[model samples]
Target: MALAVTCSISISSSSSSSSTFQSSQPKFSQIASIRVSEIPHGGGVNASQRRSFVKPPQRSRDSIAPLAATIVASDVAETEQDNYQQLAVDLENASPLQIMDAALEKFGIHIAIAFSGAEDVALIEYARLTGRPFRVFSLDTGRLNPETYRFFDEVEKHYGIHIEYMFPYAVEVQGLVRSKGLLSFYEDGHQECCRVRKVRPLRRALKGLRAWITGQRKDQSPGTRSEVPVVQVDPVFEGVDGGVGSLVKWNPVANVKGHDIWSFLRTMNVPVNSLHSKGYISIGCEPCTRAVLPGQHEREGRWWWEDAKAKECGLHKGNVKQDAEAELNGNGVANTNGTATVADIFNTQNVVSLSRTGIENLTKLENRKEPWLVVLYAPWCPYCQAMEESYVDLADRLAESGVKVGKFRADGEQKEFAKRELGLGSFPTIMFFPKHSSRPIKYPSENRDVDSLMAFVNALR
Candidate 1:
């Protein structure tokens, strides 16, 4: 059976060592090279200190495991429901170290810490103190800051552990870039980019593990993450066994405050990203993250361009009621209750609604010897709504030109056609299909005005 285990850790002044193993124990030469006193205290390594370390050699794409190779079969017995409940109760108020110890002992090599930012490195420190064989991995989104990649190398060397780097599928990434361009997320949303870059790679990484750990805290985003439990079954991800109920997710620092994590990092001398010293709190892809002002929350630095409520990137959104597909589609349309109906889109003037059959009929347009303009849009999209007046005006003005203008509301029944066949990654995507051509030319101008739309089609003719 597939099971997803999620647990939280509280911050408390407890014993630092989760095991009898001492940091002074010299097993690996790399670990012995740095003395405990050499690590700076109270904060992360300053800019000068960080630059002192030599950069590690970079690995090639062939050296990293493919997504399919990461899925390992599992034979671990499932934890009884009652026992699992007790485990949660026991760790509810436990210190981060204690929580880490329990997880490391139970899952052993089958569990890994999903290391990314400073908080995750703190978890790495805690895992090191446990003295047991543990695993660490990072999702290489291929768009991360150079400093972040250097930091990953630093952590691996500092902790004397091998960190498996997971990457997104090359084909999916190429397809997204070829169709939408490299920076389409700026126009639409970050969800699609994140899905191709982070979420899918994480899914592949988790496929081989019975449990994984994160550094999520309830206090990070009070609006979205306030209810994070100290320990519970993960409702979203499956485990290494490939069964429906076998994987466990551990958020050891779920109850730990941000300051407390920094303190742990400082006290333990964990390696951290240099960007942290520059004021970036919550780090993701380089393009999406920024340094926040003194009063702003850490999460504010991530995806700051979008609405505050829509900050998540889908990794932690499995249980949330938000429309996963719409978010990934980057249509800027929320699938809340009472969403706009098909009539709302069809009622507009100069707009022809296209159904599945209607889309199929478009092939006949190739024979009609008439260039046509079409928009794949979602009715609830604010951008699509804003373009309505201009679009209608453009259609009416172009009627005498013998160029057909139409739109497809990519919602409900027609979503599949828009997404799969048309490759509609974002809403209000205007395309001009020339007569006798199956390939449609995308609207080239960023300015969504009637004149601009007319100029595009007129130039084509």
Candidate 2:
């Protein structure tokens, strides 16, 4: 939260070029880091009139994002860039989203907006403030859960950043789905399905691009073990533009964290996917997604049935060099690069399946309150166990102060309900449901002290 202050400063100056000033105003330490603004010269601080120096926060005004606002794609411009040079691309993780950013910076080209993870948001924000034109794009492989979409909306609205969507070709995807059903990828080798539904359109989406970035952290998967070069040669682009002839394949976040992303996002007011609160370390296609237990690998929740320690797609082909076409595919893809798009994530075409958390979920805690505070804890959590005392105390205080309350435990029998309903290890965590908030405050009392917890709760309250 921004703490705005009006401090009094006494200024005295001679009419000539030489000017001198003195002040009896006490310098509050809090204002030390704040930026200062001079009011219009004419009405500048009179001799004794206290100055309402609108001290700017220590950080850039854009450093902290505002509460989420509804995001409309139209809010984005079709093509926008002032100039592009001295572009710096960081691909610590080869995540596909990060791929979008590298390309923009490398080519001195401005994309829709640079797509980034929480780890990269600060730098991305820095670039935005510096007026670097970048485009951010994400390919929602039809399998994502609702949380991912909500996060997308949150990021766009919170930061006034636009994330462009890449959709699969409408015709081919329909034909494939109509013939094979939504789980067609499973019947066919996951590779073939990914190639047809995901890779193909993905390549097409990058056709006119100068560069494409990925969040492929080498430590996360085998396919991304290569050094996080600022550029790479894309296998798909045999003869495409700069991709085929230049360093197209890039991974900026190749060395970045699965955890730091959240910290970065939170710091930047980047709204995260609600599922993060539900113990989801990594989010992908919903049908293929499940909750990961403690100690499980981050990507394990995705493709749980695969049972393979390695996480990859046909694009990487299990990190194998040689391409095995029809013989390797359990199903069929007329060509590689599956036709998937952002719509698949949004389920914009309204694909129906038993794969969702369902309508009953939509009703949970709906109409509960304008600022319904839902707490997620674990029964075994010493912090939570002790919090029971603080919870009661905080609840009483909040009730007296006219605030609503609700709570859930991660280890409770109602866990699944809470998991699906509340979102898990995003923990000791407090959430405002239905209208997921980007900056839902975590309880501050690590000591579980009643006074500390109460202060934390009521302050956010």
Candidate 3:
């Protein structure tokens, strides 16, 4: 026997509309309760396995106020692992429209669609088709093109819904511009500017939502996003509920091709940024984005001055690995002050300084009982400077823990030696080599605090 489920979705604009959908499938409540790993990955379940949906209590949008203004409490309940697993399976074969439908039904006013005046506007149309109350927002990076702002206005008028404009904090923007100048990204990198302008505003926007939908597609950048999943937990940012694993991010079109998105936009008469006609495929800040040649990928038009791997602006996945590797590969200037030598920098208490010959001699000490925690750092790197005090404190504390701590300066006469022996690719790359292990284990966590550093060292033992 099959169970029947009914959902009534109401969307109010200048012209109000209401719609009802009925399906003979298990309710989201049941799906949420089931464990994700238990579900088969290949196919849908039999009709007899379906469970009925019980009408859920409803609350008005006014009562569900926005949580964007405040830091979410850390104790908030996290979404169940099973719920994420089941949602992924249920939506695996679902279309973008169906995915939006399920998202709205489950999360209600708590779900938002992120718009960047790009092809992602297709998600806005899909939300409207659901006839459900939903939130739409965009990051208003101060450096956006005039055409993009005009397009935002057009989308607002066409949908008859207010698109919340999230702006960067005034103080943060002023400080960055003052310190780095307007075009410092050209000299340094796009990460710092993007963090101040784009990332911070988006984080503020996301703090109010339980789930968010983006227009990211796997084909957009195969190197960076080849395995974009239809739905997954956002690893970097948190939702209104600040608990770990509380937020769900939906990339409904992750599997959709670029051509399909364009086709839908044209078919639906969707309003788009006028820049598309000027040969710009992927639109970003005016200064950073440009028109690409016929054969270039869409992202090639963004951050065109940098290497392809460093194109991302830190809004989605961070370009940490790329940035770190670039920094270590001689992209940054090395400090050559006569005041500090490799021996002077690494001579802190409880820390042994290792040269190329010293590192080679470590192979002879393979039978040594205690393990070693080594740090390869460059003096000019800001991350290394910030971590210096904590690293020293960590060494002092770990003196009695049977773990040996050491340091190496990778910027001086030993630069080539450090690069050749340690295979250093980033400033302050930490590694742990257990006495018995043949190879060293690179520390993976970005946290540079002393407690976190000690915890990492302790866990290896």
Candidate 4:
């Protein structure tokens, strides 16, 4: 439960920035100047001390330039960074209700739960259980299912709380539709469409708040969300503060399982999306979601046409950690010369790093002593990163054999050439160079696990 203490913290704002909330509600400019503080953890301060901590200096006429807004934001982030990190550590194993309590306590009404109109309704339930004042918000992508829209209304009626709806800019949506049909995502990829409809609107919504809670669970997507922490500084989107590390993200149910979430909802008699009963395990926009078959993982229903390893809709880019791909020249400094440094995974002894010239020479197959197996990959690609461990293990197992295991960096300047000749339609394209034929055979399956890759190598060799 939230501590019984009250104070005030002021959020910085601009004159023209409009409220994402309903028109009947006051504009952001009106409400942004003052917020009630619900005691943060062990700390309790009267209204004066609270003002000293978070309330920015008073600006005349409620008009601050963008540059001034940025400075104010930077100060707030620096002041709260260490405290939030410690808070995250302390709440590592805390229950969803407890974490939600802490979030509500710190940010108060300045924080809002990002309700996804799906299973994320559990977050609202947790907040209600905490008996704390909370705000709820959702992105209206204009493409959600009719059932999901109805469920949104049902949630509003059940909770008696208004949901602030964020929408994409009209011109942007029109531009995308004019250039390409509504279903362009089906032909190319979902990222562009999702960026315009969901990610941008969510970004706009978050920019008006100090913190936001999410429904992310570690078990939701093995490739992307497995390491979700209970609390952390958001790595992707900025908040009202508007800078890197300026936003605090709470994943109260990060440690919880999907089955457990459903159980809690059932036990509490919480309302759920009607689509859940129809087997839509992970519901999203109408076109992107579907009913899964028995025993299939929930996320398999989302973006089913794309690689499962890269299923995120870009709302939580922070969850996709790419630190392993950081380029450093042994001393964390870039090489003075024009050469790009390769990551350690590409430099392993068992897996030879093949340059474009080396790959071209191998294609000749003249006086070749051993067959070569190589993966054309880009380090930045999530699918490529996902299979790195398995690929390295397969290379280690093949080290004794005469076959040469190698990797060719096929992105950046080399991407077009790779597509033309090396069958590089996507990241981490695997090809086998046989002993006799110059033609390189492509690995046909999406299964990139160690056992499956080893079997493919063994059969080909």
lDDT (10s digit) by residue, model 1, range 336-450: 3536422244245556666677766784455656777888876654445556778888889987888988887765556677767776655557878888787777875446677
The residue-by-residue lDDT of candidate 3 on 34-74, one tens digit each, is: 33334444345333222212222222232122432222333
Q: Distance from true position, residue 256, model 2, in Å?
A: 1.8
Best by lDDT: 4
Clashes of each: 14, 58, 0, 0
lDDT of 4 by residue, 1-461 (tens): 11222221112121121222221333222121112132244354332112122543222221111122323432442243234555666777777877877777666555788888999999988877665557788888999999999999988767766677778888999999999989999889899999999888787767666678999999888657878888777888766645666567889999999999999989988778999999887888999988875324577678877654458899988776555545433222233353554353555789999999999889877556889999997664445666788888889999999989999987656778788988777656899998878888899876777888888988998
TM-score per model over all chains: 0.55, 0.44, 0.57, 0.60
Model 3: residues with Cα > 4 Å off, grouped in runs? 1-81, 318-461
Tell me the lDDT of model 4 at 93.
71
Model 4 whole-model lDDT (C-alpha atoms): 0.71
**Segments in model 4 whose C-alpha atoms lie over 4 Å from true places:** 1-81, 324-461
**Between candidates 1 and 4, which one is better according to lDDT?**
4
Model 3 misses residue 254 by how many Å? 0.5
RMSD of every candidate to native, in Å, equals 16.4, 23.5, 17.8, 10.8
lDDT of 2: 0.42
